[model samples]
Target: MTKNSAWTILAVIGAIVIAWFLVNVLFSLVAFVVKLILVAIVAVIVYVVMRVFVGGRDDRR
Candidate 1:
């Protein structure tokens, strides 16, 4: 193969590796954000349930 063709192949491979690494990092970030949102939603639901069922007492401390 010509030197130019060999260099082109190497560049393509390097690009693919970089793209793969970036995609993995992106997915990890997305997963963490999704987990955080889910936890927040569940926490809010639990808080509402507690307020409704257990209720806050008007009694003095």
Candidate 2:
């Protein structure tokens, strides 16, 4: 093959590799955000449950 053709192929491969890396990074960020949201939701639910179960305080002795 010619030098120009070889260069073109190399460029294409480089672009593919870069795109793959970017996609992986983006997915990881999204997963982290999702996990945070889930944790927040669970915390709120637990807080509400706790309040319902232990909401009365007797301070008259």
Q: Which one wins on lDDT?
A: 1
Please give, for residues 1-61, the per-residue lDDT of candidate 1 as tens digits.
9999999999999999999999999999999999999999999999999998777754677
lDDT of 2: 0.95
Cα RMSD to native, each candidate? 2.1, 2.0
TM-score (all chains, Cα) for each model: 0.86, 0.86
Put down candidate 2 lDDT per residue, 1-61, tens digits, no spaces: 9999999999999999999999999999999999999999999999999887786464577
Q: Positional deviation of 35 in candidate 1, in angstroms?
A: 0.8
Candidate 2 clashes: the total is: 0
Show where candidate 1 strays beyond 4 Å: 56-61
Q: Ten consecutive residues with minimal summed lDDT in candidate 2? A: 52-61
The CA lDDT at 34 in model 1 is 100
